[model samples]
Target: MTETPFKISIPDEKIALLRQKLELTTFPDELEDSGWEYGVPLSDVQRLVARWANGYDWKKHESQLNSELPQFTRDIDAEGHGTLSIHYVHKKSEIAAALPLLFIHGWPGSFLEARKLLPLVTKGSDNFPAFHFVAMSIPGYGFSQSPRTKGFDLAQYAEVANKLMLALGYTEYVTQGGDWGFPITCRIAQIYGGKHSKAWHTNMPIGEAPKSTTEPSLTEKEKAGLERTSWFHRFGGGYLRQQSTQPQTLGYSLSDSPAGLLAWIYEKLVNWSDSYQWEDDEVLTWLSIYWFSRGGPTASLRIYFEAGNHSLGAAFSVPEPRPTIPLGLSQFPKDILVYPKNWTREMGNVVFDADHESGGHFAAYERPEYLADDLRKMFGKGGPAFGVVSGHSGYA
Candidate 1:
């Protein structure tokens, strides 16, 4: 597979059409005094829509991304599925012996999730391990080509990721991800571990509930985490059910109306995060990526449906034949499903675990330093997974 240098260049016509649609937007009515309790407030969407249409500068951000990220595209042959073009960011540490890491992103998130962690993890240092990282846009997300055939479930996703890393000369590597990234990487570790994938890490570690008449005694924080998890299943899971069951029905609105897409995703960005102070531009930029996505915003939703239909159960459920490779977990309180420490041990061989007092679903973006530090600790000298990939000490 040939690798090509890629750039973020949305055609002029697409930009013009987006502006036309935004200018012709019509807003819906909101209940009096309603706030996030109902959903993304009307006021928030109005301000974001207005800014996106008029004040936001797409060209500026476009140029900034192109300049900051070392992007590339390569055709990867997924088993049972024909060759598909994959878009990814590959940044190497100054130290040639730095470890190789593959960072994966999930729904409502693009390769943009790796934007913050790139610099932090790739900077070579004597005190901490450094890494040469690759963050690929899962097929049907960001600029990557979508799968044409159906039944492209978790295994297919893992196959594509592993193939991409192998094609890049990473015969042995480690991985870190959260959200959907957690499962996809877990699949990678299971299917390609020992021989190829040496270790794995995740910010969102999901585990099955303890099956006992007596509930596992929990710390105050763990008790609060269950309450938070309960709150999510009660109120915040409408999107999950919709996307997993009937994404196409919802896709029409998301694909056609920027406003509908904004409100739909904006709700998650607000609720899923730990009260991250989102600027109007930041929210708009995140939305614009979905609006201008290559496979269209709808393709990203199909993963939920495919995984739901093909897998054991919901995305949160642990997969079969769990990986025996070293696994690290960084627990963030605000994550949608925060299980007790004991619950996660059943997921894999646990070597490193760090519970952060703050942060949320988008751990790499929300708490880059925390996530990066965890990686360094997990793979640095004296760490459990150190020297897992021979000759990659990640030191100056």
Candidate 2:
């Protein structure tokens, strides 16, 4: 497999078409005083649509992304599913022995989530461990090619990630992820751990409720987390039900109308995060990626349907054998589905656990320093998974 350098270059015609679509967008009306009780407010959508049509410069943002990220694409052959051309940002640290770290993204997120994290983790320094980071656009997201066949579940996603790392000559590496990433990395650690995948970490660790007759004691924060999880299931999970059951049915709106796509994802960007202020341009750039994704915004939704159909069940509640590799969990209070410490411990060989006072689902993007610090602590000289990657100490 040949690794070819890649760049973001959306054609002028496509840009023109996007602009045209934004101009022609027909927005729906919201009920009076329905502020977020129903969905993304009409005013917010209007402001974003106006900026996207007239003010936001895709060229400038596109150029900046190209300049910042050292990207590449390679053909990875998934078992049973044929070869797929995967797009990834592979930044090797100046430290020769930097540990290789694979960062996977979930729905509504692309490799772009790793932008803030790249410099923090890969910079050579003696004070903290360094890493050779590989942030890939999971097949069917961003610039990566989507699977043609159906039933591309978590196992297939894990297979693609593992194959990409191996092809990059990372015989042994670690992983970090959240969202759908939480499950995908878990699957990777299960299938490839102890050999290619040495250790794993996640910001979103979903776990089952403790089966003890007596409920486990919960901290004030843990209690709040459960409340937040309840809130998500009650209010924020409409998209989940739709995506998991019938993604194609909703694809028409996401594919045809730029406004529909923006409102669909903009809700998550605002609600799933922990009050992280989003600039209009930043929000636009994030949304633009989905609009211009290689597999279209609809393709990204298939993981929901496929994973659910593969007996993973809704909410991925189905239990499986726990991976023995060292596992790290970084708990962000405002994350959509926050579970208690004891419940998460049941998932794997827990080595590192961090309970941050603030942040949310997009931890790497929202709190890169915290995420980076957690990894540094997990794999640093005196850390739990130190030297897990054999010769790489991740220090200068």
Candidate 3:
């Protein structure tokens, strides 16, 4: 398979249609007392919709994306499962000089989420080191094509990620991830770490696998993580359940109305991220990606549905033996929850674990410098130090 070259440019018709949809949206009437219980406040949606219809500029975002990062497409051979095209953005750095680090994003996020790290990782920031960065959208999430089969779970994601490395000619590299990215990275290390696989790392690792019969013993932190997970199942799980069962019904509203899509995606940004202050430009930039592709609903829900059905037998059957590969973690206060270092020590060789005073789930987007510095110390030549970045380059 050969590399595919393309650029992002939204067509005039799509923009016009989006404007029409924004103008003619049949808004839902809300009760004064409902507040945020019925999802994003109707008032907030109206404000965002008005701005999206009149003020947001697709051209500006397109220009910024083209200028800041180089986007490319290549067909990654998914083991024996034929070939699939994947989209990726690599900072313009020397191949040999930069450290090859792949950043995988989580649910409700695309490759665009990882774009913030270009500056800090490529050019050492005040708190971090310079390393070559590569960010890819998960399959069915952004520009990447959806899996041909029904169940493209985390393990398959890891397998396909390895193929992506080979397709791009990466021998071994470090990885950084949170949420779904963390689990995917864990699977990568488990399968390919030490002798068999390449060295890898993850920040937010999952220690407690969902038990079917007996509840597993829980630490205080694990208990909190479980609560967060349960809370998600209670409140936010509707989206997951809908996606897993009948995604088509919801897709219609999201795919047809730009306002609907914006509300759906933007609400998550407001709640999940700690950097709402940094949201104005970033939010619109991400919306442009989904708006242009008309992939708002299909891609958004498909990943959740895929994860819901993913078989865990393979993941648990072969546990990861403690590998000597250096692992690092950054625990943030506002983050839903994270495992204790002792839990992670059972999986791989953990060298660094720091409890950050601030930041949240979207640390890379919200607190790039903090996360970057930790990454620099872990992967770069710089040893443990307060906010010192190493000068490294080249992403294989």
Which has the greatest lDDT? Answer: 2
What TM-score, over all chains together, does every model reach?
0.98, 0.98, 0.83
lDDT of 3 at 191: 74
Candidate 1 segments whose C-alpha is farther than 4 A from its true place: 212-216, 310-314
Root-mean-square deviation (CA) per prediction: 1.2, 1.3, 4.8
lDDT of 1 by residue, 71-130 (tens): 999999988889999999999888899999999997689999999999999996778999
Which regions of candidate 3 are displaced past 4 Å? 79-81, 92-95, 124-129, 195-197, 209-234, 294-296, 308-324, 339-347, 382-396
Deviation in Å, model 3, residue 384 alpha carbon: 8.8
Q: Rank the candidates by lDDT, best first.
A: 2, 1, 3
lDDT of 3 by residue, 69-160 (tens): 77777777675455677877766454345666778887667777677776777775444445667787766666777677666666678887
Report residue 368 deviation for candidate 2 (angstroms): 0.5
Error of 1 at 353 (Å): 0.6
Q: Give the Cα-based TM-score of candidate 2 against the true structure.
A: 0.98
Model 2: lowest-lDDT 10 consecutive positions: 310-319
Summarize candidate 2's per-residue lDDT along 22-67 as a digit string, tens digits. 9998878789998998888999999999999998999999999999
Clashes of 3: 6
